[model samples]
Every structure is written in C-alpha cells, then in structure tokens.
Target: MSLDLPDLRTDLETLAEAHGITGAVVAFAAGDEVAEAATGVLNSRTGHPATTGSLFQIGSVAKAWTATLVMQLVDEGRLDLDQSAQSVLPGLALPDPVTIRQLLAHTGGFEGDVFVDTGRGDDAIEKLVALLGEVPRLSPPGAVWSYNNAGYVVLGRVVEVLRGVPYNQALRTHLIGPLGLTRTATSADEAILYSTAVGHAGGEPVPTWSLMRSNDPAGSSLAMTARDLLTFARAHLSDGAGVLPARLARMMREPQVTLPDLGRPSRWGLGWELQEWAGGTVVGHDGSTPGQAAVLKLVPEAGVAAVLLTNGGDPDPLVAELVAPVLSRIAGVVPPAPPTPPDPPLPFVVERYAGRYVSDVMAWEVAGDDEGRLWVTVTPLGAMAAHGGSQTFELVRLRQDTFVFAQARGGVHSAVAFLGEGERARYLHTGRLNVRRSL
Candidate 1:
C-alpha cells in the first residue's frame, strides 16, 4: 500500500488552486515510508514557492502535545488525573471542582476561550490563569464536553510547576527536542528561523501571524511542517516508542467523554477527537488561528497517518476531500463523511429558541427569520469583537433539542443544543455553554 508521491504532488497542486488556498503542505505516512507534497507559495508578496519543509501554524493540534506531556507526568507519579486542578495550581480560581483529566478531556466546565494578553513575561500563564477568577463557570466539572483552551493553558502551568521550567522550554526538553522535531517551534520568533508560511485572510497576507504569547500551550503559538506534525503523530501511532510509554499513549486515545454536538466527532479522548469512520476509528485534532488551518489524522487500524497544514483560505473541505481519498487509496481505509443535517430539516418551534445567550468571549442572539426559520447571530464580545464583528446562520433542526449551523465563511458546521423548557430555556450549548440572558 505504498503512496504514489508523484501523483499526490500533482493532485495537491490542483486542489490548492481550486480551493483558493494560497499555500499548503500535505504529508502521509504509512509503515516507515512518508510522502509529502507542497503547493502554492509561502507568501504571495514574496512569491516564494512553498517547499516540503515550510512551517505552518498547527494551532490547537498542539494540544495533543500538551496532553502527552501531562500523561508523561502522570506516568512518573507527579500528576494525578483525578486530582482537583486547585490542588495542582493553588493560586488559580475556578468555580467548579475541575480535575486534571477533565481539563484534558475538555469537561472542566470553565469558560474555555479566555484569550488574555498577559504580556511576554515568564509569568504570562500564571497571569492568564488569574484572569479566570472573573469568568463565570459554564457547568459542573465533567458534566459536559466543550472545547476548552483555557484548560490546556492550565495544564501548561501545571507542566511548568512540576518541571520547574517555562511551558515552551518544558515542551522542547520533554517532547519536541527529544523527538528530534528540528523544524517545530513554540513561538513566532523561533518559527522565523525556519522556512515559515505567512498566513492569509481573504486572499491577502495577514499582518500578524501569531496569537497572544500566553496561548502557546493551547496550540495558538506552535508552528511546524506537515511532515513534522506527522512525525509527532507517528509517535502516538507507534504507541509512544521512544517518547511516551506504550500504556499512556493508548490511554490518551481512549474515548473519555461523549461530545454533545452531533455535528462534531461523537466523542473526545484526553486530547484527541475520536471519530468512528466507515473503514475504522480515526483520531486526530484540527486547529485554526487568524488565517491558518491545520489537521492531523491517524488511522490506527490502517497503520496510516496524514497531516495538512495551510495558510489562509478554508482548509477544512480541502483536508477532508484530500485526506479521505488518499488514505483510502494508500491504507485501504475510507474515512467517514462528516455527518450532514437531515435534508428538508425537521420542524421545531422557532420562538422557543429565540433569546440572547451570553458568555465571556461571545454572545448568541437566536431569532426567527421571515419564513419562521430559526437563525442565530453570534457577536464576538469585549476584546474579541474588534477582530470579528458578528456572523449569522440559519439553524437547521437535527432533533428536538439539537440544531446545526453551517457557517458560510468556511462552509463549516457546528451544533447547538437548547436546554430548559420552551420559554424558560436557560442555556445554548455550542463550543461552550452560553447562558441565556433574558427571555
């Protein structure tokens, strides 16, 4: 089941141009053979053609790295999964009793997307954690599954506290450097030392390529090539070989919680999203920054892993369309098609879901459209609003309580579920739980 590298390079070039992707790198690994293809330019302004080694911001895909480090500590008897997060970092203030395992599984119930710029000091993660004292708790710990970036930041601080080093240093000393990921880096400054791709928004290069420095642990600041990412994935696929212990690596991919959103993968493990594809189970993570997107997928049964790194343009469909066919052809496994909403959507009371739901990072206003269809307008709040104003989507009912919103921007879809009675609905759960403001 060897991949035809020549054919893949041509296919990637065609796909990149068709999808409006300015630059992209796709890599596939099976057994010991790895094939990579790069398409388009690293930066449109420079017109430098992208190469196999070009680095792209891998985003939240780095969370798997953070999770791996935590598991390493757990294996060394320095951290306990069931221990309360306050026990590890006593200065932190969280409303619920969150455990280390909950943080990894994204069931910590805290407002997850707290992107506070706490300066470039070594105390950035500590300062970022302190700011969470003001954020409201979304639910009781381990009660629900929401994508929690802040939780990973907390894990980063835990790593620092136990290792007696900064988060980035700990990542390098314990994981990146040890694994020989020479092209992988933790900050924009480090990434500049390599052949890095400039991110793009609306077919134009982005002014800033990285997010706040404090977000390094949560996958906001890491950059690497698709091949390097697959190298990291290969460690897990090979059951941690030289890095993590075999048992710990296996435990990380075990489904820990059922994700409420029907649109996403059905379950989440420690840091990996678990999807039961038609061919078999595929586990991986996808990431997004300003204009960059990346995805890593591993088919354990097929002994195949794939990574896609792109700067600008929607990489979601591009990765989906490419990864499936390539994996199926090379590994003899077909990745499952993403779940689509019921055609001619089911009818539900539109007024029942009409209300304003608010969270620390964003707000959602659900209202009725002209034809009585339900639509939800999401407005970024506080510091985040200046970057992206607002977006509206028509909700297609998937069930009595669940609905899906297919955003036009990236053609990406997310699920939202309503809780509480008809008129007294108190919360709308999406990436995070947004509490209803008023009727």
Candidate 2:
C-alpha cells in the first residue's frame, strides 16, 4: 500500500487546523522520501512558529527509550528479564514475585499512585517506593495489567543500578548521544527552563508548573522534540541498525503479552504497544500527563513511522488518524478492523454497591437500576459512561462478590474490591483501593 505523500500533507494541514493545533511534526518513509515536516506555532505566547526541529514534551514516549536502555542491559548480561525488581534495587522491599518483565509489561499489580508530583530522580523514586509500601495490590504479580507508573519508576532505578551512573547520564550517553538526538533529555530540572506550552485544566489555563520526574521503571517523565522523536521512531522501524543491534531492536518490538482482548488496535509488546493497523501492527504507545499527550507509531514491514506531540492534554487526533491511510498507501493492504465482542449479562446484585463514595479529590454516586445495571454519576448532568448488561454492566464474582469492572475489553481499570460480606470497600482506579466502605 504505497501512499500519496502529497495527499497526506494536505489532509494533515486541514486536520490540524480544524483541531486548533498550534504545531505539528510528521515523519514518513515513502518511496524515495524518508521525510519530516512541522507546521503551526511552537509557542503561542511568543508567537514563534513550530519547525521540523521544534521540541515538544514527548511525555511517556520516553518509555520506549527507557525500555531500549533496559534492552541494552539485557544484551550486556547486566539485567535479567525475570528477576525481581526488589532484587535489582535491594532494600527497597517491593512485593516479592514481581519480575522485571512484569514491570515493563505493567502486570506487576503495583497500584498506580501520585508520586510523580514529588519532583525528579531520587526524590521521585523514594516517594514511589513509599507509595508502593502503602498501596494495595490489584492482583498477584503477573496476573493483571494495570498500566503501573510505579513499574517504570523502578525501571529508572534499574537503569541507575546497572550503569553505576545516574539514570539520566546513562540515557544521554547510550541513547541521546549515540543517536545524535541533541534536543532530547530526561531531566525534570529542564521542565522549568523552556517556554513550553502552558497546560489548561477545566477550561482554565494551568500555570507553567512542572511535573516531578518519576524514577518508576514504568514511564512517567521524559521530554523531547518532534524531530528527535521521529528519529527514534525511524530507528525502531528500521530495527535499530545504526544505533542498536538488529537483535536487540527486534526484542523491543516483539509481543511480550497478547492483548487482543483489550479491544481493537490493542496489544502490548515488551514496552511497546502493538495495535492492528490495516492488517499490520503499528507498534507504539500513547502518553498523558496533566497538560500533555503524545503518540508514536511505527510500521515495521513498511519501514515508516510517525511521532506526534501535543503541548496540551487534548492532542490533535490527526497523529493517530493518519496511520491507516498512510500505511495503506505504503503497505498496499488495508489492515483488518478490530473485532467486536459479545455483550455480557447484567449482574443480579447491583444494589449493594450503590450510593455515593467520596475521596479527597472527587466524589462519585453509584445508583442502582431495575434493569440490572449500575451507573456512576460523577457530575449532575453527565455520567462516567454506562456500565451494565446484555450490553454493558459491572460484574461481581459470584463466589466472592468482589467488584470487577468488566467489558468486552476485559478489565482495563483495576477492580473495586468488596470484602467481608460487602460491608466495606475501596475504589481502586488502576488497582485495589485501601479505603474501606464507610456507608
């Protein structure tokens, strides 16, 4: 499926404009062109136009870079994929049985936490380790996928241990320096240096506040420009020929977990996400922080890849929307559409989990329905999507009556556990919550 590059450029401009995008950078491999482009403004406040080299916070896309670093350690025999993270960073005392692979794949059942707000490097790592001591597990290690940031925080520490240098230094020496990606760096310190796009929240602009750099092995903090990201994408798509060995590169993209049930276009590789695009897999991941979002995709077979970064939380969808059309032109075959799953039955006992649950941050009201569905109201006029049966609904394990949010996609969020005859409970968004039912 060879693509018409000219058509793609036209569509991208139109789409970005429609979405109020300030800037965009695109990279492609079409016929003779291993090309890149940037459009719109880099800093709306300064009135500077974005260029092909303009930097944007690549957000968690940095995880792939970190993952590649781990792969290097693997190749050098300094790290074992199956060893416990606790072993790598001893005296930290993380739960036993959580392998390094679980951290990379986010299956360690480490409940997500707010440690990223604590600033960067050692401080952030210490905060995460403390949170790990308090957060309840969602499931036994390796049993579930919860998108744990704690996992990546630990990975950052792993990088430090294996290299005997600060994680940032190793990243610079091995990744950024070797790749000639001058604009990229993994410093929380720099979060205050640039004239970055200010983030907005609740329709109001958030100040130019910075994020605490995370030491979790799972990706939390890293920054880069559009061109540097494109360079990274191309390297992966090309199997790291120049920057990393072909064997290690292949390992990075290989599927470590089968996530076919995570819905259409969803799969998980070592640290890379695998999604079906026009019958081929577009391997990449999406990132989000308070004020940023980014996506990086690569088509291995076609030798084409794309990197899209947005300064604001609401990113222009054109980054992902362009993949299929571009890949079809390049690959000559439309990837198969994602499949749909049969709806499950509504649970019989939805009343037990009804009523309002308040937390420090927000409040929620869970109301029961006669139709056997449970709806959660986070606002007066709007709800958090419908959850219940024959179509969609929450499920309770009949044997234990534990609450698990299930859909055709299985349980993407951590289950809200019910314990001791359902008298008390806690709301775990990505893992089990510690708060018992107060009502």
Candidate 3:
C-alpha cells in the first residue's frame, strides 16, 4: 500500500493550525513500512519546531503500557490478575475485594480521579496510596465501569512491590528498555533530557510541565513521540515476544466491560478500549493532561497502527477527522461515523431534572435559565475543585433523559444522562455518576 507522506503532512499541518494547536506529531505503521509527520512549534515560548522525534505527554494512553508491564508480571507468575491489591501492597488501604484485574479494567468501584501531588520523592506512589485511606469507595468491586486514575496508581504500587523497585525503574527495566523505546521516559526529569513539547492551556503555555510524581503509572508521568507510541501499538498488534506473550497481548484486547456513556468502541478490555468499528476492531487509548492531548490507535486485522500527540488546543476533533482518512486510505479501515441524536429527539420534564447532584470529588447543580433552557453548573470538589474550579454550560436536550454539553474550550460535546424518571431520578451520569442530593 503506497502512502503519500507529503500530502498527509500538509493535511496534518492545516488541521493543527485550524485547531490552535502549538505542536503536533503523527506516526503510522504498516508492517515494515513506517511514516511520520510533525507540524507547528514545540512551544510558542521556545520557537522550536516539532519534529518526528519530539516527545509529548501521552497522558492516560500510557495506561496500556502500565497494563502491559502488569501482564508481563502475570506471564512470569509473579502476580495474579485476581489477586487483591491489598495483598500485594500490604500497607496499601484499598478494599480487599478490589482485585488487580479490576484495577486494570477500571472496575475497582473506588473513587478513581484523585490527583493529589505526593511530591517528587521516589516513594510518591506509596505516599499517594497512603492518601487513599480516606477516599470513600464509590461502588462495589467489579460492579461498574468508571475511568479510574487512582486504580492505575494502585496498580503502579503493585508493580513496585512485586518488582522490588520504584515504579519508574520497574517500567524502565521491564518494558521501556527491553522494548527499545528510547524516546519514552517515565518522568519529566528524564524527559527533559530529550527534545520535548511544552504543554499549553488555552493559547498560553502551561506553567507546569509535568504531573504529580504519583501519576507515573496512570499516564500523567510518561512522555513519548508519536513514532514510539505507534511502535508500541504495533508490538501489541503482533505477538509481543520479548515484552508479552501473543496470547496475553490478545487478552488485553478482549472486552471486559461495556462503557455505555462512551459511544465509540463502547466497551473496554484490560487496558485498551475496544471500538468495534465497521472496518475492524481498533483497540487503543487516549490521554489528556492539563494542556496536552494524545491518541494512539491500532487496527489489528490490518496490522496497522497510528498515533497523534499534541501540546495544546482541542485535538480530539482533529484526531477524529485525521485518523479515519489515514486508516481508510492506508489500511483499508473505514472509521465509524459520528453519533447523531435520535430522530424527533426525546423530551424530558425539566422541572424534575433540575436539582443538585453530589459525588465524592465533584458536584453538579442543574437548573434552568429564565429563557426556559436547562444549564448545569459543575463544581469540582476537594483538591481537584481547588485547582480546576467550576464550569457552567448550557445543555442541549437530545433525549428524554439525555443532554449534550458543548464545552467552552474545544467545543467538545459530552453527554449527560438522568437515570430514572422525573423526581424519582436517582443519579445524573456524566464522566462519572453523581447521585442526586436531597433538596
């Protein structure tokens, strides 16, 4: 399959500028053939042009790497997916029922989005788990799917304890070094040694370049180039001989849970999100940090993979638009179409839906404007609330119980569903489910 690399580069550059992105890198792999392109500047402040080798924070996409490491331990008989996290890290305070597999699958049913800075010390993950002692369990283990950040941190602790080393060292010795991913680093300190992209928020460069040390395993700590990311994806597409057995790699892509709120792929595997598109099964993960967004995707049947790493602006839409054409033209994989609202749209009683919903980390106050339109004011609670503050957006009704919010930043649309009917509705579901609080 011949690819017009120059044409693809031009298209990517145009898309990046249209999105206000500071830096962008894209890489594609088809068996032995590989192609890559970069556009914009690494940092507006530095005026450095992004190259194919420029590293960008891959965010939660690194979760698949961490999962791969955990699977390697499983391959060695050093860890059991069903083993309780508390048993592995005896000092850790997670619920005993929360198994290693649940953590990997984001089904541990615990408060998962905790992002407290545990400091720059080597014991950061340990300290971060120590802080988990006070976090309330959101649901029973293996009950439901929630994008759990804290669960991955616990998994990181599992790696450290089982490997008898820090999370960073364990990742390096077991995965990064052996896989020959020279551009990938576990923390900002090591990443600084390479040509890197500085993250940006809005149109301004981000003040901080890295996440808290504790987020290393959860993806806040790793940085890599688009080429390296696709390389990793390609390894997963084949028998991961040195890194993981082909069977285990295949296991990681098996559907573990259904993600109803997330329309695409709508199901998750061990670490990969399973998107059963019309073309084929494209397994991958996306990552987002303060001012960076990254996406890594692979079409296994086609033996093809692609990755996009960006420093700033809303790269989600750009990824949606860019990856489809690349995959279709290069790998003969047709991308899924964007979801549309139901015909005639479902109607709901606005009066009953308007109320205060509360959760461990955030709160949502749903009310109506004088113009009879509904709006939700989201307030982040706890430490996250202190940092991210609050955001209010008007909700466009899509169904009797569902509405979509076009977020201010990237004009990204997110669905909000009210479970139950009228005043009997018990919860409001958005990134995570928030139970309705009493009046």
Candidate 4:
C-alpha cells in the first residue's frame, strides 16, 4: 500500500476547515515510523497555531489503555475474566454476577454513571459505588451489553484494591511509564504545560473534566496528545512497543458482541470497538467529553492507524472525513462510504401478531398498520418500528422483528426481541421484561 502524503494532507485540511476546527494535530503510522501533520489554530481566540505536539483529551479512547492494564492483571493471574464482579471486589457488592471480561467489553449489566466528574481520585470511585448501590441492574449479568461508566468505576476500585496503589499511579506504573508517554496522565486536574483544549456544551461552559476526576479506567478522563494516541494505537497493531503482547491486544480488539442496525453494524470488543472494514478488522475506540471529541482507529491487517482530536461540539463527522481518505491512501483500498438506507417499508404480514401478551413481568400490545407493518405499543408506551413479521404472528421466524433502542450517540440502550408464532410471541429487552402474546 502506497500513501500519497500531499493529497492526504489536503483532504485533512479540507475536513478541518469544514468542521470549523481551528486546530488539529494528526499522526499516522504504518508499522514503521510516525508520519505526522497539523493544522489550524490550537487556540482560535488567541490565534495559537496547532502544532504536532498539541495535546487534547483522548476521551473514552483511554479505555483501550485501561483495558490493557486489566489484561496485565489477567496475564499475572490476579484477575479472572470469568469470575464474578463480587469475587474481584467483595466490598463493592455489585448487584449482578458480572465478570471482569464483561466490564472490559461492556457486556455487564452494571448501570452507567451519568454524573461526569465525581473527582479524580479514590473519592470518585467511592461516589460511583454509592450511586451504583441504588441503581438497579438493567439485565442479568452477561445477558446483554450496556456501556457502564459505573462499571469502570468498579474496575478502578478493583485495580486500586489489588495493586494497593491509586488507579492513576497503577496506570502510570503499568502503562504510561513503560510506554514513555510523557504527555499522558489519568488525572485531568494535573496542570500540564502543553497546549490544551477545553470542553464545552452547546458553545456554553459545561463541567470541565476535573469536575468528575475518576479513578475509573473506562477513559472518562485521560488527557493525551494526538501523537501519543497514534503511538498507542500503532503499538497495539503490531505489538511492537512490547507494552502489551499481541495476543492481549487482539483480546481487546476482538468483537465480543454484535451491535447491528446502528447507523452502522459494529462490534464491541474488550473496551474497543471492532468493525470489518476493507479486507480486515478496524479496531479502536471513540471518546467524548463536554466540549471535546476524539477517535483512535487502527487497521491492523492493512497496517495503518490514525487519531483525531477536536475541542468543540461534534467531532465524529469531521474525524470520519479525516480518516477515510488516509485509510484509502495507506491501505490501497477505497472503502465504501456507508450508504444511507431509505425509509423502511411496513411489514407485509403484520396483522397476525396483533394481541395482548403477558410475560413474567411485562405486558404489551401488538397491532397491524394499514400498511401491514407490526407496531408494538408496550404497556409503558414502548413503541418500536418493526421490520419483519408474519400476519400469523411468526415474529421469531422473522429476523427483522428484533429491535435495538440506543442512546443519542448511537450507544445501544436496550433491545426488544419478538420471536414466536402467531399470537404467541416472545418479546424481551436486555433479557428482562419478557412479553408474550396473550392467547
């Protein structure tokens, strides 16, 4: 694969220009040396031109690093992926039987913490646990995948308890120090002299990261530079840096669950998102903090990885625009841009499923539209757009009957499954609230 550097640079600049991004420092590596680039003003107001060394919050992309630390424990046999969360941190008393692997992959049912900055140290972990004590489990352990910030708080506590050190210190000793990442730190509160970016909400001041300084390892707040992030991604691609072994890196990159019907069909690995792009797997994580957004992606088979960081409201479209061209240039594969799907038509056989069904806990009504599409008005007004089913109520027979409801940014919030014969449908969400057709 050959890379045309000049053309790629123009594309990047064009993307940054489109996003009103005043500053962007980007780096690309392909199993060899770092090829870097920068653009715009690091501080638009003061007119500080962004440089190759400019730093930004890596956001949840920090999860890959945290997962690596957890794997270090796994390699040492101190933590078991299959063991219950209770087994690892007995004092926390999590409500489910979630295992360490689930936490890594977000398969655990632990509720996510909505409070952003609880504080950056042990107190953050304590507040998170207190909050978790009151939040109910969405599903049984391992039954479904829910991205849990609170779960990572538990992971931070586990790291602290087992290593007998602050989670930040442990991250340093295990990851940043070994990798010689001078600019990376778990604490957002630390005063680093590098050019920094601030986060905002709707162009207004929101809580800065320090507000909820977390020992949490899920990358709620880890500050780093674009070059450092590219270095981290490259290391995982070839296992060259020796920070994490190749096998452990794959474990983090391998898809543990399939999230279909997203704006795209993606997979969730251990703290990483996996997608089959071009001819291989593109493994990475995306992070968002108030005024900041970051994405770190590495295509291992193609041997290229890229990182993009921005301080503003939306970073995804801009990041995607930046990386797509680089991926084509370096991989020599012009990947197909995702095609927008047209409005889905109503099911041809929706009448058979109309009825009231009772399950162990939940109840719902299923009816047909004039277009013959299945419409489920859940007892609590859980309306879903059904794709496929039979008028005889053979929902499970239709793969399209399954529906996943996700959050604002496309994170899967809950899934509803309707599978069964006419008037005898089995409906479920996160494996809880089973809804069946009333006979």
Query: Which residue runs does candidate 2 get wrong by more than 4 Å?
Result: 1-4, 7-9, 30-32, 120-123, 188-205, 215-221, 260-262, 332-366, 370-373, 378-439
Tens digit of lDDT per residue, candidate 2, span 111-172?
55434355654555656565666555555787655566667777777887778877777778
TM-score of each: 0.95, 0.76, 0.93, 0.77
RMSD of each: 1.8, 6.8, 2.3, 7.2
Per-residue lDDT tens digits for candidate 1, residues 250-316, read 9999999987655555689998999877767888999988889998999887778999989978787
RMSD of 2: 6.8
User: Which has the better lDDT: candidate 2, or candidate 3?
Assistant: 3
Scored by CA lDDT, what does every candidate get?
0.85, 0.60, 0.81, 0.63
The collision pairs in model 1 are none
What lDDT score is found at residue 379 in candidate 4?
Answer: 43
Q: Candidate 4, 13: how far from true, in Å?
A: 2.7
Q: Which candidate is the best by TM-score?
A: 1
C-alpha displacement of 312 in model 4, angstroms? 1.3
Query: Which stretches of model 1 miss by more than 4 angstroms?
Result: 339-343, 406-414, 420-424
User: How does candidate 3 fare on TM-score?
Assistant: 0.93
Compose the digit string of candidate 4's lDDT tens values, residues 343-405. 353234454445675432235566665644455554422211221232222122123545433
